[model samples]
Target: MSLLQKIQDLEDVLKKEQLTVDDLVAAISSEIACNSYLVSAEGKILSYSLAGSNSDKNADLALKLEFKQRVGFVFQTVANLPLEANFLENDNSFAPNTHMAIVPIHHLTSTAGHLLLTKKAQQFSEEELILAEASSLIAGIYLYEKANENNSDSQHNNIEMVLESLSFSEIKAIHSVFTELNGLEGFLVASKIADRIGISRSVIVNAMRKLESAGIVNSRSLGIKGTYIKIKNSSFLEALKLKVR
Candidate 1:
């Protein structure tokens, strides 16, 4: 079935009755013919669904272990919203050419967790990518409500402080860098950001400097080639997403 049709069917089921996080994981996995995991921002597994025997029969202990080892990597990749399919290659733990769709589950503006979907197949279609993103957003909202119910005032206060640290321009730069993350591009340079936002290179560099001081981005010089920049952590992207929005 098409990805859109599968998503519509899932929505129908979701509307019929509330499903626990685990139930949602299983349903998403089945609909997409892949293994699905809901992991906390700190890389704890909240729920997971193993592909059925008829599907991806190689979903074995080794595969699970591989995912365990790479869960942090997965979260880091999708900490920013709207990321493309990340192709994990040359990892003996998984089958050759495994594709992982990493989606950040946000709470309000901050990322509370991640949804990781994996299949031993080629790249996912654009339709599948859209479905994965929508599923993660749903999961994020559910998790956000759950966290709010359990969190103390001090935690919320701390999060607010972090959100207030960045200026608007810095947030935009971070957002632009995150939106471009894909298999083809990893780290972004200042010039790229300048061109993307129609701002001057100097202005972009100044923003990056502030972001670096805030520990949101890391930069390095390549001599004549100029400097390249990257987000320092996934959590920073989450916070920036919340602040910028």
Candidate 2:
């Protein structure tokens, strides 16, 4: 199919009511003939669609971890990554044969996230790179609209009462970890955060309890999946003086 036709198809997909990032990833994956992922600027995997056959569960998990790590590295080090598509050679021992391309998804002048494409033993062509860049622009617009729709006045005031209940260290711990978390739909293991930040799990647990009691956050224990937490109020992060990336 011609690139213009493929992009037109994507535009048709976007016209549907309640279109989602997963839907976008699936459409882009079909056009590019590779696994595609939409990752948040904070390194959270927003959505993904795999091409061809699916990998086993273990390999799939490894791939997600690798993507998160790579995105985090890009956010930390590549402050001025261009809007055009760029390639990253996979040095991961678990998936050494993988070839990856990334395009920054921008919200106006600032980057909001990334569009990632990966396939084994196949390098992306120049045409594919252009298509990916176009896809990123569409994804950015969708995300910006969603963000505006989700904004609430209650979110700005929800943390005022909770602030007095938290200690300095507790606030610091919560800011350090929770800022990385994707709201509601995205969950991370609490122990994993503790391990990564070199803090005791008890500190995280206590902070969560206080926040939950104040109705500022909600959490559910997922057994082996650890804790799934969603911030009810983003103002808490701002109140704690969390640094914006």
Candidate 3:
């Protein structure tokens, strides 16, 4: 297939929400007719489809370790190069004919991971190199989107935890003050909240303490500047029934 057509096929694979990096690697392996792996920047093998079989678990572990070391060394060696495919000739006696290509998977300006391909006794064609680069880009996008989703879920969970920790009165106090602020940025005075809501200063202070303790907010006394309040989780606005402004 032409490189453009192969890239279009990879794009179709990416459109599937259920598609994983492993599936993507497998597709790339089939397209290029070689063993493929997706290794994280930290040298963890995220996905792979090796040609040979290891009969023993220990052999598999050793093989994985050796691959990791190889990837790490090559990654460090080419760290200064532009994000592209780099070829290496393997010296391992066990796989004398093995030739490897490493493509750095990039997310924006940062290296997110890598796409590694190994072929026995054959140098990679230009078309194969370009396909690997395209695959790496797709893998980077997939990994980055997954990371964002996980972060958003974690933030939502934290907001729920803080919401569960609050008493009805405390929620009311928080709603009153935050609503009055109307998405204003900067420090807010506890006494100001107390005066506006007709609640005791101690009530406002305690509520802030709970938020701070839950890691949902940050509070610091600015002395005459009242108290510096910074909400770490913006989802708290919707959770507390306040405007998300």
Residue pairs with backbone atoms closer than 3 Å in model 1 (clashes): none
List the candidates' TM-scores in order: 0.45, 0.51, 0.78
lDDT per residue as tens, model 3, 1-245? 77789899988888886887667877788777777777787876676765553322222222245556665655321211221233322313235566777788877767777777777767788788877777777888889988998989998887887777777767778887676666634667778888877878888778879888877778789898787777777778877874222
Q: Highest TM-score, which number?
A: 3
Quantify all predictions' global Cα lDDT against the true fold: 0.63, 0.70, 0.70
Error of 3 at 54 (Å): 15
Q: Give the per-residue Cα lDDT of candidate 2 at 229.
A: 82
lDDT of 2 at 148: 77
Residue-level lDDT of model 1, residues 126-146, one tens digit each, is 766777777876677667656
- Rank the candidate models, highest TM-score first: 3, 2, 1
The sequence of per-residue lDDT tens digits that candidate 2 reaches over residues 129-236 is 777877887888889888976755445544665666677666667876676674443576777787878888888899889888878788898888777787776566
Q: Rank the candidates by lDDT, best first.
A: 3, 2, 1
Better of 2 and 3 by TM-score: 3
Model 3 TM-score, all chains together: 0.78
